[model samples]
Target: MTMPQTITVLALDVDGVLTDGKLYIADNGNVMKTFHAHDGLGISLWQKCGFHIVLISGRNENSVTVRANELGIEHVFQNSKNKIADLQSCIQAIGCTTEQVCFVGDDLGDLSIMNHVGYSIAVQNAATEVKTASDWVTSLPGGEGAVREAIEYLMKANGTWDSSVASMMQEHANQ
Candidate 1:
């Protein structure tokens, strides 16, 4: 089997991929979701290394806004019904091909985009149908370390994981 090209852009689905697939509403109709700090730092490092990242979601929530801001994520699309079309536009905006893109998703909404990307990754807790369609399965689940795993895999495939992570680790240790 042939390996996919080094990923230049990462497209992610919000609910399942970033927030463990739970949809909850508080008594006041507010939302709550937990985000992993490690995932944030990993994403920062990945961006510093020149990989572009985009987040796509069918729903909008407060947690997504906060997390995206914290991570310095560039492209974010929410309440999108036609996910595949939005993803195609994103790919074009990045000036990249399907061969240079990696998509991480955990539900059926993400399948079409996954099919078009070079690296299709699913978190361990993803739906069974999603798992079957993915090119790789992560050990971590969403809202845990799945995003981090995806970024690390992309860095590794691009031959920059070690040096980039080493620098980040060193900086953290010194601080």
Candidate 2:
């Protein structure tokens, strides 16, 4: 498995990739999902390095919108029946090519986009076929800091991980 020479966009599938593939529905029909703090920080770090983040989900859940807003992710496509098309639109909107995108997914629905991106990643608990199609698989499961693991791997491969961490440490020291 070879890493992309450059990755400018990080495209993600929301359900199984950001959450643990579990859904909570209230009696009133409100759906809820949990996101990991570690993954949040990892995303922040990725954006701080000047990369873009986009979210594509097959379901239309308000929680996903709320979470994306909290993370300052501007490109969000929910209720997407065709992930590849949404991803292509996102790539165009961001003025980047498919070779500059890395997609992390965990299920069959994510397979199409995974195959279309430059680097495809699957979480530890991903479906067998999804894992087989991926360039890399995270050690952690989804909603368990798996996104963080993928971000660190990409940053390390791009030679930005050490410096980014150092900058964060220096900032903490000053604080």
Candidate 3:
């Protein structure tokens, strides 16, 4: 539980972990992706709490870049076949270490980073092997608020959940 406070960055895999593991390919070679609003909000909250976010994916998709940019996530490494190496580059750029990172994914491709991170998380839809290697598993499946669930769980562990909620509620009340 205390480990959450030590987490300074979150490295996320895009396809399975963020988009239901499906690729929508149009007949004309167009690609599209759907992302959960809840997950976006969760990322915003995490950033507001002063944490960094990094996006890592094997496919080179414009949609992923757009989404990452929209969320203000600057550490985007798309088409990264070597997630662990890419993550290491990100960590170095951010001046953090493996011990300050939380890696979330749903496939075997993520196993390396999952094993190296301080806290590893897997979506409900993650493969059995991925889940087995994770420190925590989300109740919701990926692309369906699973990222949000993971963020909430971490916030709770870091002793910031109540305060974050109170702050949001107070903001709403003031409005």
Candidate 4:
């Protein structure tokens, strides 16, 4: 099987990737999203592996900040109209090249930037054209561990999967 390019940084779009593309808006303006635990663990593993992770989204959701904070993701750009700009900014901030970046997204809004990234992945549930544009299409649907699957592929492709996961497991087991 062919391997994905080296992924030093991963940039993702939040809504469809992390939350099944559904918004839970309460009468009082509260937002709720169901995130898979495995996905969270995968992100933690990616961080442990020393890969930079960022959330670059077009829309702003209340729960995103909470979730990102929970995952210790420091590079988050919400309400970005031009994703490429945010992506460029993120690349600069992280001191990486476009070839070191992997972009995972699920909609039309993500097309331009995804096209430019080194590796572009689409969730199984993404729009047809978006899927067509991706270099890889994940087996998991949006919000159903797609991000984790991508992370695992990337981590393994970059040769950091095993040790990172072991370290994360050990750390958790110690608590």
- Identify the candidate with maximal TM-score: 2
- In terms of lDDT, the poorest run of 10 residues in model 4 is 1-10
> Pairs clashing in candidate 4?
none
CA lDDT, candidate 4, residue 95 = 94
Q: Residues 1-175, candidate 3: write the lDDT tens digits.
A: 2276678788899988888888889999989989999999889888888888899999998899889989999999988878889999889988988998998899998998898889999999999999999988999999999988988887787777788888888999999
Q: Which candidate number would show the highest lDDT if scored against the true structure?
A: 2
Residue range 31-67, candidate 4, lDDT tens digits? 7778877788888888876788989877787678888
Instruction: Write down the lDDT of every candidate, Cα atoms only.
Output: 0.84, 0.90, 0.88, 0.86
Q: Residue 87's C-alpha lDDT in candidate 2?
A: 86
The TM-score values for the models, in the order shown, are: 0.92, 0.96, 0.94, 0.92
**Residue 138 lDDT (model 4):** 96
Clashing pairs in 3: none
Q: How close is candidate 1 to the true structure, as a TM-score?
A: 0.92
Give the true-structure RMSD of model 2.
1.2
Model 4: per-residue Cα lDDT at residue 145: 96
| Per-residue lDDT of model 2, residues 11-84, tens digit only | 98888889998999999999888999999999999999999899988899888988899999999999998999
Prediction 3 TM-score vs. true: 0.94
Give the higher-TM-score candidate: 1 or 2: 2
Candidate 1 residue runs with Cα over 4 Å from true position: 1-5, 173-175
RMSD of 3: 1.6
In model 2, the runs with Cα more than 4 Å from the true position are none
- How many pairs of residues in model 3 come into backbone collision? 0
